[model samples]
Target: MLDLAYDLPAPKVIRGALHDWELVIGLEVHAQVSSKAKLFSGASTRFGAEPNSNVAFVDAGMPGMLPVINEGCVALAVKTGLGLKAQINLRSAFDRKNYFYPDLPQGYQISQLYHPIVGEGEVIVDMAPGVARRVRIERIHLEQDAGKSIHDMDPHMSFVDLNRTGVALMEIVSRPDIRGPEEAAAYVGKLRQILRYLGTCDGNMQNGNMRADVNVSVCRPGDYEKYQESQDFRHLGTRCEIKNMNSMRFIQQAIDVEARRQIAILEDGGSVVQETRLYDPDKGETRSMRSKEEAHDYRYFPDPDLLPLEIEQGFVDEIAASLPELPDEKKARFVTEFGLTEYDASVLTADVTNAAYFEEVARGRDGKLAANWVINELFGRLKKDDRAITDSPVSAGQLGKIVGLISSDAISGKIGKDLFEIVYTEGGDPEEIVEARGMKQVTDTSAIEAAVDEIIAANPAQVEKAKQNPKLAGWFVGQVMKATGGKANPKAVNEIVAAKLG
Candidate 1:
């Protein structure tokens, strides 16, 4: 078993009129499976298709159209379970969660409630350097997504787009281990990163590929500990479900506002009511949507259309073996193998594409130097241009060459920056450009000593000041570098300058 223990940070306390309160948050993240087809239909799961173009007979709930489960979605769900380190139930069943909505053409959603596909996993959220919180996974159930209802296009009528109908979603439910708004956002982010790395979900919140329903409740400081000591809900106050929060910023904002609202209610001598609510970003408040539904409310029953799903141990083993190195494992390897700070490793490994790019650039080069160039120089430039790593002008091979040049003392650090700019704009080999442009560092002792001697002789008064204060020696080194157009080897320039000044 993985060590999921870490020091929990101080709870985010909300000062109420009557009593101070602490936030307890849990997230139900709905991640669309990265499959081309829908869960139980043959329709294409493309996002921007014409309305109803992607709908199948079964998806429309047409008469006598029995649902046939898609094998690909099941495989992806199992893959997600393995990625989360969750238990994959060999025999899991699907049930119909009966609900009525205009977008839900079937009048019900096929989801797992009793026998979830995955069970009992934990997510270790890295809150800070050496500080982590273990958020337990209650279950991950496979379900079909409802079609979208577009209301704003017309004032008098609404339109339904069935592009997302019957789309497979893995409802990743977490235990209420999150104590604050920021941690809530971080937990979702970490979960999204893991999902993206697993190739099971795209984790694109904007595209509606992923979204979270946050369960927020407020309690007194010691109440949370009491709830933890004994598995009881009385200690943890009634939680309101904030529905369909896509943005991380909004997720945090909603939690804070909701917690404060709950505190305000309790202070006013009213008990909190459990309900489903929607977060209005513009108003920065949550409004009640409906009373929170329980299992009996949903009228959940086993789906007669589909049988119980059973998989062999070999099947699960195959997926586990095929699993790529996850974010946490990759981050740990980067810190140990490359001697990187945990912060740097975390930044690099936050995205799978960025991590791959870093690995390629650091393959044979000095890992620390490569990381510095990639993070500071390359990433900074990319950000300035409003570009992603994939759209970066400098390729990994080009960056690796630049780092190699600096590592081998073929070019000074300053010269390397200039080379990076030239390659980023014009595009060429780093070494060939250095040679063609005469950008190689002046490492020869004779040339460097001559330059240093000239600087010291020209600035006798400054040299005396440098001899008095050792820090003043940097002026002469700067002069030497300027004289050589920043091509002088910095180490060699410093050595010569110090000797001549002394």
Candidate 2:
């Protein structure tokens, strides 16, 4: 529902020797479906196993070996589509995309072309705090992945690893709504986050679990607006596809470099070539791979082995009902229910584990106090040790107990932090830790007042100066804290100090 086109000014279209241009982009993100088995085979879909160790006869394309559909894979694809709020097709069919590659042992890929599993979805990507952009999803189809071809180990021969072969992929196509590189990166990140939350894809680019092909085109400014208005794309100019971008940072960098490359060519009175390009991170540039392929190039046709996939509406409704509270909803609830700042809620909900941990620590306690301890003290310590929230030494229950003690005035803030260290390292109940360490607050008003009176008597000259300047009275409170070994309640010290000074 978020509009990306809002606040974006339409660029002026110019027809000149050196005319300014607009860059229009769309993305085809291939996310490996998170299932234990491959799409059409029983081969284990594990990463970094001994080469070909995870392959089956069907994955290796052994003669007469037939392909069988993996229902778990279908469920994942459907879940991902639901996460994007896309229309789920009750009936869809797979087809054979015939191609020839040394790594593609089947010589044909089983893919969905004619009827995809999902149709027409939209993604709302938050670019910054208040800015959101919507990118339209054209379709999401399932396809089997090809194997890996290793050419580096030998000069005269290439080796193929079919371990990755027949693995499931969801090709989520986006309309060319992106106008800049930063927005493109943001769109991919938001998609990854949603898929992860859905438990449909691991969304790990480093492990080759997800990748994107960015289609970029440059036109005279305002041509993009005209295309939006009239649905005429001829005015948008030739498009180049950047293939297999694996990193978010590299995606943005590739776009910037590719746009400038096209701009330089057009400025020199040369037209930009429409081709498939690859990005070289070392050189920070994109080079042409080949002319981009059309749908007919692959010779798509309905597969003979697999039938059309269909499910009842009740199944789809079940998935919708079981959906977890996602990131955006959790963030809003944290801000509204817990009284947290937008920034604080965002930080806590960015990761599911962190949000769950925060909820546990905040249970039945002061929300702001729990958030302060978790975000400031706990997260700071975890970062120093290079650990995640799940790896924290202090459990959520222990943290909640610590917050309770602070709220009940059983310990001062300083003593609470000391208790945290004890519980974090020594591993014991907070009350027991405070008792053993004598870290309980000096809540006895008589004891606190004695320390405050002693400090005031020792600094009569300072007390006289305090009467002249009320702000200077805080100096006496600090002195009382030092006199009591930091065990005096800060509020009690302040009250006693103020009374004596007056």
Candidate 3:
């Protein structure tokens, strides 16, 4: 029932020599499963370890070693499938995808082919306000990751790091529904966010923990509409694949360049070749890696060593029950329950840690005030210091306490900010910082009035101007604030200033 009418841009028709060209894109996103052990071995799945230090005999594929499926990895996979709203295949099996790579210790990689763990899902990617495109998910399969190939170790020699070998990965395959490069990147991002929320993946792109393979092709404009109506893929053009994109910016660039390249080739009375391509970030163009390989080329077959995976409905239900609130649902709750604006809620709930911190600060306190401070003041300072919420100088408890003081008029906004600085820098109770620095609000009406009178007398011309133009009353407010040494409650100061001006 989620409205997707606003999410997609109107399709633009393309005219090429053969037909009006439409780009058909699918994606295969690889997300490393969050687990301490490798998929088939007890070897540590730690990153940045010394080369081969974390490898076990099984990971190295020594003689007489048998593969064992990690139960934790399976659980994580189910959690991910549920998060994607995918159908969990209770009887998924593993197959060997035969391939040759310097880093693959095993001659054949174990992957899901015949039956995948997840099936038929959809991701709603919001590109702009009131506009979202639903990218259909074909399948998500669990597989063992191969080791990394480091070609830069030496000019002549390529070194293989087996530490990452047999690490579990969730290969999420999307249908060819994405129309443009930006949509592809957005789809990947939303997938990453969902996986992270499900606790299945860390969603880290830099450490090779996550990556996307973009499949792009172009056909005539009306062709896509025809394909949508009939569900015929041939209605679109033959697509080529771009492999292992880690950066979002590069993803967009790759799609744009590839689309244009295909368009130009067809325009020049040439045919577009279906191939695996690599994006050169420096040159901002895609170069051919090799001719696209069909599924038969991999020689996929059932693995003789491992048995098919099966799980009980109870297990899946348990994972679902334990799931945390997802980003979209949490954003909505932040707006409804916390009385926060949609923008504020979205910003706070972008990350789990930030959302948790905000919730803790909002508990039993003014939601709007806590949201304002967290988003504007605290988050702004965190950005300036390049610190994450987990590493914040001020704890959620401390922030809540500080806001409480401000709410009760125990401290003026200026004094509260000063106290916040002291607490952030010195690491102490908010009340103690206020007490030690004499940073309480001047709530006494008599004291505030006397300060206001002095300010009005000193700024007589400004007061005269204020009497004529009510908008100019802010000038007197500023004077009163300055006269009271910024200790007077800002709300009370405004009222006193207005009365004096009148």
Candidate 4:
């Protein structure tokens, strides 16, 4: 059981003709397991292969093709369960989910229904600095994915591609704790971050490697609390499952539209129906696909071809020992160790590669300074170029050297930026470039004072006005820095200008 006292943002209220309604949302995320072969065959799991070239005998559901389980996929699922802080079931069974589709050669999906591999887990979704929502995981079951039915190739006849058939998937289902569109999206994003950090799934939605089935419903205010206490579905309104949303933006939009649709129906004296719906991105609305099916509708039964899966306690222990530092832990460490704000720590730890690069730059240096440079300077430049951190032209070492120069006051912040450009485009050591170009700051008191005196003499009227208004003294400082070609130390220039003016 999860603590219900955690702070969640206010529910998104939809105004109806009679009363306001709130959104209740849950998610079923299908994540493709990271593996080299199919779950029950030796076929390659590589993406973008020739239409059916990666299909094996069992994947095509041929006669006398007995299914053999792939151990790698099971191990990845166990790793994911451990990463989620979930209970890993040592003994689990596979069931046949009866379904018929053109792309489903076997006519049934091998899934875990009664006995799942993972049990209850919790995901702490950070809404703001100190606000979070705890979304509970109902279960994570292993299943085989169906293939694709391509209709765009030929209008008269559709085509079936079996490359994706039999690929392992972990259906991570969450309870109805999400309150709004934004919260729903954040829940999915947080889950994706964890899965990516665990190296269980790539979480690539564009390639169809990961997608979500969003269950959305609208209830009157105070009904959510009643449902929380009673643990009954009556308090929550009837839910409609939106199928296969691949994009985060689309997921949020779909939920909002669906909630409003439900609200409008109930306000118009129409009771909401339980069913499955599909979201049309361009249309920005959901249309009915089919009536929601109960468990018996699928005719689920245990598979006799494969025996129940049983693993030793030592197996779970070994996998637990090998778990990596997850995103939340890493973010907390970044905030504590680096003295960074929660926002900065979250941004830096969003991606594993980004966090690693930042650590390398911050090692043995001022962490706050290093974070500023890495987040603002490096990340801004990379975004402008449409480049990932792994593909960055500026290496961590070079960026660290630039930050070191700025910290040591060897170069002004302005000069540091200039040095950054030279090193980024021309590819040279930051220190060498600073030395070769003579771009060091003009920290010598005599040089700065002479420059300040010359500026004051050239502008006598401005100097008199500056004496009356000390704030206007910045005029002389700017002029001196401009006179020195922006290489003069700003602190030194300010001090000399203020003394001479006084």
Candidate 5:
């Protein structure tokens, strides 16, 4: 986590009338483990269930009910830790995080603070092509999620949904390594990618499966570095937490809005308060929720019902062995083996499904052509249609065939695009479509030469201009393609046109 090999940028300080202020951010991301049962109870952890239908007696905090730790949840936490390259603590205990909320019938949330299962991990967040930042993970602790308290259900009263009660959560806490709003979002995105790859957490932020509590603080120009060297917390200024951020767009917006609010306070000769705040994206501002509490305030103590978790190194090794080729490794392989650009590889490998699709499409084909079609044509259409890669109408095999045809000069790129459109909407094989519609490229050099001669003879004026300026020769190729109804191989047409003009 504290590895200093990365080329992380310095804190981006903004100049003001009084002084330059640097933004310091840390995120506590709570991701729900993708298990069927709750953390301690046998209650189903299914989403959108009836208000309390998924609750077990233990989850409902019935009298005399005790918690039994779920081994699956613990295994997931370890798997996630390994995915992040973190230390897995074989022995960790659960503590009661006492707080009063209607949704939490138990009156105390089971969590780990002093002894966390995972520690000292780092996530590499890609800011741009060939640029990244390594945000340090302080610890990842397993905890029980409190249920939902819905305020808009009724006019006079709020409704409580205990279905989420006792659900398992991996609260991944990070150090204050993030410098900007975009970096914070990138960090979260990268972490979510890793978790999804591990199959531990689904990384679905919109469904309350994953949410971030962002801690933001402001400092002077050199204060960030000073705090790093001295290991002091106060140099970073008083922090305000924006809670339950679910969307990347809103996350960046909340940080910027909060930073400006803090700046205004400091510029007015006022001190910032340490409190929990909520970002209202609709209103474009943050409002106070409650004062931030220290660990002592929670009266955290080891839970009596749950025993200290103990595991063997062999368990960790097994999980590590089962790990998939993660996004970073896959991206590197795509760039090295497929000759893809850094940006294209990053975009393609950002999601598991997208990467798999691209891999299949690029297999034994011209990797560059496949990447271009996937990144530009297929991805563009999916974005326009509001669809995921999994929802794509054109399968990987179908798209790969399109690229193959283009590579083999069996069809021109124009015809290949037409073939893709037919497969996406109408659904058919690229080869069959080309054959059925007489769309196969005329790669025969003699046929292309005859078409070029006919076009050149008819359009003598354009040919004379093209010969004067060789760059204008593109017009001759276009004319030949148009004469052949875009069925002629573009390369062959270009060659024939160039030779005739010469």
Candidate 6:
């Protein structure tokens, strides 16, 4: 339950020749559960194994090999449900979804159709600072992933790799609550962050650990409200499912293109047909793959090989207790506790590793100063080098000490940059480096006064000009800092310079 019922303007609307239209989006996100073994067999779920090497006999659909459920996978699904604030069905059953493909060795995907493990949750998508929309969760079902079919490996013959066969997946289906392309992307990002925070899934789209099937449709504005009140889906129009979208940019692009395509057909006095489609990013359009299939088309039936999955209320409570603090909770805490702006908190809490690093650096320290150093200095440097927070050369403890030195005026900001560079390259103590290299700020008023006096004496005309125009007083401050070998405390120098000039 996100408080996103408040009215907000729709950002994406197609101004068709006949009328205006808005996009409706729903996502069926597939996330690979983080476990050491496959869903039904103990085959290694590790990535990048030799082709077909990680296959178990059951995963390969060998004759007489019966599938057994992995207990850890079940726990992960339950944990994810609790994290999403959804209802957990203590007794849920699995069904066989009949399909045929080269990647599917068993010619069917074992999924939950009649009853899913999780239901009726909502995700609060941060569209902008202090602006959000809630996307309701329809269901989450656990299923086995198919193997990979490589067509380019050999031109004469296609190759199949069973390494990913029988891997566990949580298909999180969202209600068609999204109103725009950007909202759709934001919704996906929010789910990915929650999954990663819960440790249920890694959410690595590049490696195919998580992907989304975007269902895009178009309808008029008031029609959506009518459907909302009546709970009728026809007002939303025919939704085409865009399959296997891994890139967020591509998701947005596909939704826009697909919506316009549907609008064109409707405007031409032709009815829109529901179907499965593929987005070609190169061509910037969606091509029809096949007619959309209903649940009956899959011929779903209770999986006879496995019994109905039944767990006690105590088991559900146990997994619920083990759930981690999700993204929204963490982001709120970061803002209140650290005095960080919503945007800063959002950036810091975008990933689990970044949030942990920021916390370690900001603990018991000036939160604002720590945030500046972590975001502006450390993160800037890491981004420059194209490295991740986990690959940071400056450890959390080291970065914390550097911020401490700057806050205490033990070192000026310039000297802090120097110290950071030294630690980043050679790796050493921040305080020790400041002391060893004489990077400490010259807080002694007399020493700074003497430098100011010398600089004034050397440039009499310039001192007179500075006194005439107070704005030029900073010139004397810079000169004094240089005379002190860039060690003068800037605030003290400004004070003493103004006094001497007056």
Say which prediction, candidate 3 or candidate 4, comes out ahead on TM-score: 4
List the candidates' TM-scores in order: 0.97, 0.94, 0.94, 0.96, 0.96, 0.97
| Model 2 regions lying over 4 Å from their true place | 1-19
lDDT of 5 at 249: 93
Q: After superposition, how far is residue 209 of candidate 5 from its true place, in Å?
A: 0.8
Candidate 4, superposed: residue stretches over 4 Å from native? 1-5
Over 4 Å off, model 5: 1-5, 459-472
Score each candidate by Cα lDDT.
0.92, 0.87, 0.86, 0.92, 0.91, 0.90
Residue 90, model 6: Cα distance from true site in angstroms = 0.4
RMSD of each: 1.7, 2.6, 2.2, 2.1, 2.2, 1.6
Query: Which regions of candidate 6 fall more than 4 Å away from where they truly are?
Result: 1-11
Spell out the clash pairs found in candidate 4: none
Alpha carbon lDDT of residue 380, candidate 5? 98
Candidate 4 per-residue lDDT, tens place, 241-342, comes to 999999999999999999989988999999999999999999999999999998899999999898999988899999999999999899888888989888
Q: Worst ten-residue run, lDDT, model 6?
A: 1-10
The digit string of per-residue lDDT tens for model 1 on 138-193 reads 99999999999999999999999888989999999999889999999999999999
Least well predicted 10-residue stretch by lDDT in candidate 1: 1-10
What would the per-residue lDDT of candidate 6 be over residues 1-502, giving only the tens digit for each residue?
A: 2222444536478899999998888899999999999999999999998899999999998888888999999999989988888899988888999999999999899989888888778777888787777678989999999999999978899999989999999999998888888888888999999999999999999999999999998988788888889989999998899999999999999999999999999999988899999999999999999999999999999999999899889999888887777888888888889998888988899999999999999998988888888899999999999999899999999999999998899998898898999999999988888888878898999988889989999999998898789999999998888888888999999999999989
lDDT of 3: 0.86
User: On residues 244-348, what C-alpha lDDT tens digit does candidate 3 reach at each position?
Assistant: 999888988888889888998978888888899999989888999999988899999999899989899999999889988888788778888989877788788
lDDT of 5 by residue, 273-392 (tens): 999999998899999999999999999999999889889999989988999998898888888899988788888888898999999999999999999999999999999999988889
User: Model 5: clashing residue pairs?
Assistant: none
lDDT of candidate model 6 versus the reference: 0.90
